[model samples]
Target: MSKEQTLMKLSAILIAALLSITSVAAFSHSGGTDSKGCHRNHKTNDYHCH
Candidate 1:
């Protein structure tokens, strides 16, 4: 493949990898909880106590 084509492929792969990583990081949790045993809030991304 030409140099430009190879670079484009690499860029695309890197972008896809970054997006996947970001989504995983954003969704994956460590089972966080508050004093009252409330879990995280999906809308605010903060822990809440019941």
Candidate 2:
């Protein structure tokens, strides 16, 4: 309701969003896995980026 309270809430929401994005990178796997149709290890495959 108040200006100060509103700013505080906005900052908290921003921080939470930023942290969630950073956390995603931590769990992310950079290496691609070989699948039924695609051999990620082969040089010819281009389905996904590692």
Candidate 3:
């Protein structure tokens, strides 16, 4: 492949990887129960795992 094409592909792949990693990190730190996701449940005073 040409230099420009290779660089572009690499950049795209890198951006995708970074975005996925950031998303996972954000979700993990959301403070949810059972590792589903964090949210307040109206039925009870418990954190939702949805």
Local accuracy of candidate 3 as per-residue lDDT tens digits, 1-50: 99999999999999999999888766543344554556766579667554
| TM-score comparison, 1 vs 2, better candidate | 2
How much is the lDDT of residue 7 in candidate 1?
100
Error of 1 at 15 (Å): 0.1
Worst 10 residues of 2 by lDDT: 32-41
- Residue clash pairs of candidate 1: none
| Top candidate (lDDT) | 1
Provide the TM-score for each candidate, comma-separated. Answer: 0.53, 0.55, 0.51
Candidate ranking under TM-score, highest first, comes to 2, 1, 3
Candidate 2 lDDT by residue in tens digits, 1-50: 99999999999999999999999877745444555433354566556543
Residue-level error in angstroms, candidate 2, position 38: 23
Global local distance difference test of model 2: 0.72
Residue 43, model 3: Cα distance from true site in angstroms: 21
Residue ranges of candidate 1 with Cα displaced over 4 Å = 28-50
Candidate 3 to native Cα RMSD, angstroms: 5.8
Q: Runs in model 2 with CA error above 4 Å?
A: 28-50
lDDT of 1 by residue, 18-44 (tens): 999888866545556766778978898
